[model samples]
Target: MASTIVSSIGQGTGLNITEMVDALVSADTAAKKAQITRQTNNNTAMISGVGSLRSALTTFQDAMKKLNDSSAPSFNAYAATSANESVVKVTSGNSAVPGSYNIVVKQLATGSKVASQQFAGGSSSAITSGELTVSQGGKSYKIDVANGATLESVRDQINKELGVQGISANIVNGDGGSRLVLSSTTTGAGSDLSLSGIPELEIDGTQQMAGSGAGYITAKAQDAELTIDGLTVKSAKNTIENAVSGMKMELTGVSTQTNGVGNPTSVTVAQDNEGLKKSVQAFVDAYNALQTTITALTSTSKDENDNLVLGPLTNDPTTRSLVGDIRKVLSEVGSGDQLTTLSQLGINTTKEGTLEFNSTKFTAAMNDKKLGSEVQELFTGTNGLFERMNKAIDPYNATDGSLATRKANLDKVAKNLEDQQAALERRTESLTESLTKKYVAMDTMVAKLNAQANQIKSVFDAINAQAKGS
Candidate 1:
């Protein structure tokens, strides 16, 4: 506002002092401001480029992790199939040998359940509260009931006191008013559930009504009984793992028995050629995507008008170094039984820095017994392809890694630019203030000179007018 007043004053002398001062100040600061803006924009782009590169690396790593199913890598994967899915379902790991087994499910494992005698009142009826001991599979826990506990409240208390140990209680209301039902998730023989407490909830046959009025066993605990290759096997759960080597079976239903013999379901274990091919193809695709991201960040393109447009990280030393490191790992040779490098397994890097996978070659390699193991070792063994690639990327993507340090430095640069911008603003304001004061003083002087000249002209005009009149 003061500058505006000064400018108005300077205008009285027919000099645009405000415009002249603005032109001078802009000329003096334009170059520095442009340079700072250009550098700040470039730094921001570089930071964003770093993040994109990191995200691409993380995505590639996820694809690689899928191939590593366990601590001991098993790229030579296996699959198991059951002839009758309604009878059983099977899954296999790489450690399983290719073979066929006859499986017959005779019985499924079930948990035990006990029910208290029907209460004369409904589920909301009050029950005697006392210390109750719940026993399942020989494991026991005691629960203290509040004096005013109802049937439903007692059931809730039992569930609250017992967590994942698998003991639970519920009230079943039927023609027999309401009964407290106790159930267990622990399946198998010798795991029956029993309770000893007030006569209303006892099931151990100790109370006078234990035989009839007390609770009675509704379902008895029993183990899953099955036959594998003519041998009987027992398990506490329907899903049996230890019955087979590197394979597990989940029993869905019992097989139909004929003349005292249960029909058997055929289970076959074999190499999963299709699954392996898909995994390798996924790896190739992920790496190619990462390569494309790197190219977009580090290469330049042309605009519609034929002007060159620079990429975010164009000519960046760190990006070039990272690309070189990954390429070096991909080009390494390996020692294997029948394969040496990725090329032997139908995987090769194209000139554009992306991998190409040959499905036919991969399938043939997997079909060969000796080559299959070699292919597995090439990708999952010590210093394998993925291992080396992950190692090379860790330094750049880790929390305190190269990319983090670079971003921090760029942030500092941005902060410094902010400081520079502030300083420039202060300098410009000061220059404007000084120039405005000078112009205002000059304007005041001009006004005084004009005033004196007008007074002199008035006196001279009066003299001339008097002479003319004479």
Candidate 2:
């Protein structure tokens, strides 16, 4: 019956009721749908903009941290280079004075290797069970040998127990059967291997201890010997540190000439001016990137139709205040004899509100003998410019700070918008269902009245036909 009514609906009303119902529903919900769409777009864009702003702030802070490192501050950086890298390598710190040094690598440090007396019975030869004490490099360790332990077992025990102490033992096969060889990683003089209570394994006179068994000294321990500017220097290791203040020198090869005098490898230490400049440039670039982000967030522009388009954060006071705070810090002067502010370092604010780096001016200022060292005080230490800049940005960029709170609020607003949009869709669906039902009923009623009228007209036509036939 409902299908019949649906088929006859347009027969009576001569109208597309389904199409009309859809149009009515669309008209009823258009304004609210459009409003929700616009607001959702706005909230989503705002959330994204806040994320971008926070990321930019973090990047700028990273740049600040690079310059403000308490250890090896960027401004006080020094470079040490060796003329002959094959013979020597050098590293310098801020405390090193700028000067040239004639370095000569005479001999590197050596460790001890000892070979025990050969056993005719080879690796499986029986060894006495006792506590064996091994000493080397001012350190000692004792290993317990079980009864009925072979030479191989003792060697394994020595390697297992003494390996961590920089001493190891291995068995070598020669004409005299298997000989146990013990070696030490400990270098420098008076650090030769010494053994006690293991006469079966000991050779003779390795350590020259009175009334003590010894081992064959395959290699003797020796200290590393070198010279700086013809001044003699000795070290326990190839890497020498205390010879020069704030400098570490590594001897790689011997450079003793035929005339009995060692050839010199020139090492030069200087302030790292170019490296500091690069660091400064990176700082400037990071700040500029942050400035660009802020400008994009707070500035307005024209759309394709000439309509004014507002940025996601155009009306946000926090963004503007944050930029103002950073600018205020940058503008302040510092207490330095040769440098007071970043402007003196050739970092100046442009009309666009971003920093412009003048490399030539920076180079000249950094090269000035009086100003070069003084510049270190400006960008380093507790009162440095980078530290100040970091402090200025801390309030906004920290966790639970202004930007985080702003982002949280924007996210909440976005969630609210989503809820509103869902509620609107439900209302639209309810309204559409109601309107469709009412229009369908009205169409069915009109169709029934037309059917009744057709029945009456047909009855009259039949009567008239009968009369005409008579």
Candidate 3:
């Protein structure tokens, strides 16, 4: 009987037992189908969680990068301005005639003390009848310095030397006949020149220093001072571009060459900390949700005999391994100038395997310049916490990632359950058809037996009636 029951359940039977077994098989198929559906749902949730976590991590990393970049100083503060006018001079030579003439500075060249003394003045003329020696290239030529030497005599002698290419002597209108002056064509720190062998002669009414020639004008300005987002900043340059990353400020009235100055200019610098705070909060919330989901999936209900619908996946080695891997990835550090660990940056793992943020501490650290700089460094280097962590979690991307792998496995299980359900359905249909045919044959046999019994009874009654009449 037991064998029969087993066979009837295993194969199609011409009885109601087969139908009953079919119903049980169908129920089993349904349970498995439901299991696959649940797993699919879980797969979707896990993928979403991983994606949200990755995005949050990226946001934190980007903020740290900007902070690190902003901490460094830059150069933007120097300018040049014009100072005073100069005059050129020519004296007398022995052979030249004394003549009052207009002298124009054809070209003005300035050289260092050493280079200037090495080259002699080119052409010369006698003015005021004085003997003057023309010195150039460390060589001096003795021309007759007398009262009658015209300015033209001095010009000609200085022009003769090869090293003296850029200097010219000119006579302009002054108190004592025409006054001699020297000038430089170049401008800058390197252009100041010194002259030797010149006596008391007034050009532009300012007494020229004994050795130094016409002074060049230079632009002067001071360092910039201002407050940005309530933080004071001092920079030597005019433009504060890198004071904070993604922000650049230009001082309107302040420049390297400002003429009128009291306080050159002022500007306000601010950052959107509120928006950043909200983003961080979202990350924390998402992380907590993921943690709760994992906990629920692994936990058991109070009912002892309840169906173990999720099966071994709740404690399966494969599932546990994946969870562990993901957790490890989230705990990793970032790259570049990131001085603070995830915990220090307000992200710490709770007992329930979720992340918690210390809002007060984090806000304080951000406002603190020194702490902020250190935190920025932790995330900005090649081996920084963010970079490493990002690398570790890269396998969970949308296509062919870790989460995708899990989802594929779940789909395969669902397909297998569907195939089993189809096979069970065919068996149930076959058994139902065979049972109906068997029941119909039995009913025909029973009807024929009843007809024979009825005929026999009628014959006996006829025989008795004949006997009694005799």
Candidate 4:
């Protein structure tokens, strides 16, 4: 592939110039190039492996959040149940104490409902315009009826002004004619319905279009009455809360018989054991996942040829130390009297470093009067397993924690690889240029020697011919 002069070197000196130069250049750069490729590949694999480890650790942290946080749902949560759902219903919060209470419904508060006199001209009859004032809980509002307004339109006007104030108006039609009915939206003594400033409609149903005075009042407002353990209680509304410490009781219906007394309804509040059990189980599963990922990353396998194949992080001592730290925290005994460690609650670690829960023993722990209280504290308390593990992991997962530091170190490794690869490439290029110049020089020298020898032989032949002729 050289000029005619360089190609002639092979013919003149019997040397394979092009092939030799190619072999020499390849040999000179092979070792360094191979080292660069191997290191680059290892750095890339480590980045991927560490990324997966961080993701798994993040998941474990999320599970820990539920167990360590006091506000979260746990076994300490309470539920309220009512013996007579028809008469009463109850709900409780975490603050509710576990106990039973008897409640009696004496009366259900009723709102005021009243109707007006029928219109002589029916639903479309015109009525004299006037101000209709309604009073409830000491709050009063007025509905203005324009002259020539129909019976139905009058009802709509009243509703429009008082709807937000717990008042409703409707037109009721009967044999007499179209009647206007007024009612309260809420049930309570303070929410009574009454009318004024319409005399004709006062005593009968609808007021006379010609006369004016005050509207009718058919029913009065009343308060709800109930008893808790023979203690009378009054409420402006049917729903009662804070009366039983976290228990919210709702009055459904009025008492059927007696002097404001009926059959007692038993309401019970207790701790939810199942909820706490599930939280612990979730923690166990998360721990196992962390264990599995660590084992796979640090493990080794045998190839078909009986050679050893190392895991991605087989050479990472930091990962091994982290795994050791996790195992140590899991086996720790918390600062609790009755139940100290997870083992006390029947959570055990296997030979492979995975956790398992024994259902029978766990049930026993939850049912144990004294142990149960301590068991709940073991995982949810300040120095509990969940809290301790979360605190330990926080340092490693923080912005400048171990995981973050490791990732930063890997980034440095990647950058260094790039620099090394670029430097090697430049060196290989310089070496190739130098080798080409040297090989071409050697080819030129060999070609010049061949040309000189050919000229000398020609001159010698010519002299021999002359001698023969003489």
TM-scores for every predicted model: 0.82, 0.76, 0.44, 0.62
Models ranked on lDDT: 1, 2, 4, 3
Q: How close is candidate 1 to the true structure, as a TM-score?
A: 0.82
Instruction: Give the per-residue lDDT digits (tens) of candidate 2, residues 1-470.
Output: 22323442365677776677668878988998999899889988888888999999998888777677655466655788999988988887657788899988888888777777767899999999888878776666888989999989999999998888888889887775777778878778777887777778654324532222236454477888888998889988888885888788878888858688778989998978887788788788888999999999988999999999999889888888888999998898877775788887789999999999998888878676345565666776557777788788888889978889988888888888889989988887787677766777776788899999989999999999999999
Best by TM-score: 1
Which ranges in model 3 have alpha carbons more than 4 Å from their true place?
1-246, 249-266, 270-282, 303-313, 329-338, 367-369, 374-386, 396-398, 468-470
CA shift at 393, candidate 3, in angstroms? 3.1
lDDT of each: 0.81, 0.80, 0.44, 0.75
For every candidate in turn, the CA RMSD to the true structure comes to 4.1, 5.2, 23.8, 9.6
Candidate numbers, best TM-score first, in rank order: 1, 2, 4, 3
Q: How many residue pairs clash in each candidate?
A: 1, 1, 80, 13
> How would you encode candidate 3's per-residue C-alpha lDDT over 304-423 as one tens digit per residue?
678554522366454465458657856765442433466765778887788888987677656653244343235434565445544654565335766567657756765765676576
Better of 1 and 4 by TM-score: 1
- For model 4, state the Cα shift of residue 53 in Å: 2.2
* Model 2 weakest lDDT span, ten residues long: 204-213
